[model samples]
Target: MQCSYFDAGLCRSCTLLDTPYAEQLTSKQARVEELLDAHSPEWLSPIASPEQGFRNKAKMVVGGTAAAPTLGILDGRGEGVDIRGCALHLAPIHDALPVLARFITLTGLQPYDVPSRRGDLKYVLVTANAEGELLVRFVVRSEDVVSRLRRHLAALQETLPNAVVVTANLLPEHKAVTEGEREIVLTSRDRLTMTLAGMRLELRPQSFFQTNTPVADQLYTQARTWVDELGPASVWDLYCGVGGFALACAAPGRAVLGVETSVDAVLSARATARREGLDDVRFEAGDATEAALQAQPGEHPDVVIVNPPRRGIGETLARWLDASGVQHVVYSSCNPVTLVRDLEWMPGFRMRRARALDMFPHTTHLEVVTLLERVDSPATDRPRVRMP
Candidate 1:
């Protein structure tokens, strides 16, 4: 993939684009192997996929002028470089850039200047699934430009009828995060629905779904297979964002409980479960680690699925899991370093299967899922360990 924009110094966000995609995958695989060797060698495996145009979400910085809005990286001095047609985005996003830019210009929306911090529109986030339906959210500093935004919304809907959801996020304060306190729906509906792995997920403006929807489908399918093979009587999904794993494992007789911290995500999960008519699936909003600790022995889970943040599970959670009488565990992590670190403390648990899902292409980030099972006896066939 030869990127002329990158070569001309227009944007260096994807610094590895100069290198061959195969070489990049090899390097990342080696890094994962080294981390596993030094920590949990049994979990190491060679799992690499394509690394081109796989990102399903685009978060572009608005800069330059409203007439010619630039979409790309922000420089160290807080300047935006125009690379909207870069090779990393999906084909639809690349094709829609010029049209969106022209619409922004015609609507007279002011592009936010980071250094000066004196504009209404801060950023524009666009998300699309495999089906090509788009969900757009505009992060604005204030809601003073309602009339202008309303006009632009009409124009955008006419131009792109496939846009399922359009929202405006108002952030009156100066913050780096893309979210805000108030979200106003510019469209008739408040949610955008997408299908993944035979399940429908409802996405709001600020909801945190996986960026790579296709690979996310594969990841969830693999997790479901692992759970089914284990024949778990009951399962607990910790840090379950929107209950992806919980809903996948839900069956007629099996019970699955999903625990998450975000109230919106819990509501979405419960709604999905109800829509699918899965009576055995349930979701709750609370501290995942605390819920796990407070679970009574009689309600001991047969399997526990943990999909933690980049930092991985904390020491307290790991200790509690080790003492818990769970027979099987599934761990999904975006950071392999933390995953390996946590696996060292789990006793009598051996790795059964491991897979890598290419979630963020053209970047160093990857998602990994590992299944672990407990050994019944003290003396058993332990797997061989190799150091990197």
Candidate 2:
């Protein structure tokens, strides 16, 4: 779990690297309980993540020269730190980093210089699944290097045969963003398949997937277990990125609808649904709040699963859910501070059970999933089990 980058102060992304792994998990569990203990809900044991080689994705900034490109974060001076050997990345990602760096040289693609803003490539994004297949993306300033990338892609693929998907993303602006609107496919394959809990999840280039693949599976499995215990006939997954939770909860008779804003993600989700022959499960590209607010009483689901951003669900959606009178809600949040704020809006619902998942280890970040029930719902109330 030791990171040379952290010890040398080259990269402090893992702020808690100095602390022991046991202490990190203990601190995270203590913090989450302090935030939610007032609700007096049953607490499940916190899920711990692997200490090293867990991240499935690497968003390395392209810096330095084309002859010797650096694949890592930029220093305060806007120069690359060359952290290709970062311990957080999975084996496939670590192996592909050197190949990608070599590809930059072979393609003669200039790495973007932050202060000067006079280069073609900005970032090299690489994502790998459990199967060892990879999706490589080069974020460039323009289409100026598209021809070079396409021409030498075969040469790069020779070294990294597991690179099934390759793409180029244009970020024409002089801003600090990672990608742009236009994307060009460099390989025949356009999607990467990530298998979790006996289900295959396809991911388009822009589709969002968890960086920690193993921990993500645990997260989805926990959600599925809770949903099965509740046995809701109909469920709505808001902000459903690639339909991970929605697909996980899908049953023969259950109707699951996933709402997401990204069309690519929706397409990926739909493809997976078709492959699995889950006709009752569906996905649509739309805003979560709008879809929730537009749902009529008859269209209301028996359960609503919300995996909102760090901002939580916001007051508007929170207030709507408060008055919607839904029987149950499964809320997954990365920020408990915002989660507590959203809980304040839903006074009609009470937390039944909650668990913290350590999605991001070596840092203060964590994910908490809470099952909420309407205060006056007809379901029989079970006594809350105390946690150790």
Candidate 3:
């Protein structure tokens, strides 16, 4: 995808901007093959995203003055690069950005100046659902401007009619993270609801969701299809952010449980299951790897589904899965390098099939989903003859 920000020598996030879309897919598939061919040589055609305007979230840095605020990355010299018209964001984000800038201008909210260590507004995060509805959050250094921004909420809402939830996050310290420990809700409703893969899910400001909606849908659909074919009696989803996989895999007789470290994400997942009356699915807030080791007899899962972060599921979990009696494992990884590192421990299982999803376009980042099955023991099946 062509980007004006990249053209003007501003944002260099998209490393493969000049590469053709087809070649980009080929390169990603080849990288995965190089890493995983030993375990799983079978592959499927990589799922591709549209060349432009597929991003459903925008995290724009609040820079410059409120009167003339900039919505993009900041330079080392503390100057802002105006990327409000970036082609990666969806139409709603592109449309709401000018309104958001105007809101900042009208509210007299000062953009946080990193050099001076002053100002209130530091970042503006906006997320869009399938219906183009938006959830906007303003990350500020303190609560000094919360009342002012809340006072002019109507004007911001008037500018962007699709905005359903608006929140104010306070970051009291000079830290690298965008969010803080305390979250002050500015909207009457606490959740932003959306539909994906034929399931309705409610999301909070802090909860994690895929940035690309179409590819995320494809990812969930592919996982659900595989699980449905397996028809496992029980499934455990590890690192289940908001229970995306568990919700899709839950069936009438199947028992599904999702474990996440974030309480907010666990709460969101439970709320979704409760809202849908999914009695067979549940979620817990805790470290998944430790919890799985102590899982009760009744709660033990036959098939395990893991959607781990960039680091992959560390050695402990890999060794546990390798020795566990579980018959099948569904692994979804964002980092192929770490994935291969963890896969080496699972010598007992063989990769049945693998597919790549182009979750982030104009970049090298890709999501891979693989299904692994434990090979039957020789004692369990009688062989006609042994090669000698």
The CA lDDT of each predicted structure is: 0.77, 0.90, 0.86
In candidate 1, stretches whose alpha carbon ends up further than 4 angstroms from where it belongs are 38-47, 376-388
Q: What are the per-model C-alpha RMSD values against the true structure?
A: 5.5, 4.8, 5.2
> Which residue pairs clash within candidate 3?
none
Best by lDDT: 2
Among residues 3 or more apart in sequence or in different chains, the pairs in candidate 1 whose N, CA or C atoms overlap within 3 Å are none
- Stronger candidate by lDDT (1 vs 3): 3
Instruction: Please tell me which model should have the higher TM-score, number 2 or number 3.
Output: 2
By summed lDDT, the worst window of 10 consecutive residues in model 1 runs over: 379-388
What residue pairs are clashing in model 2? none
Best-fitting candidate, scored by TM-score: 2
253 Cα displacement, candidate 3 (Å)? 0.8
The digit string of per-residue lDDT tens for model 2 on 228-292 reads 99998888999999999999999988889999999999999999999989999989899999987
Question: Per-residue lDDT of 208-248 in model 1, one digit per residue for the tens?
Answer: 67877668888888889989988877888999988898998
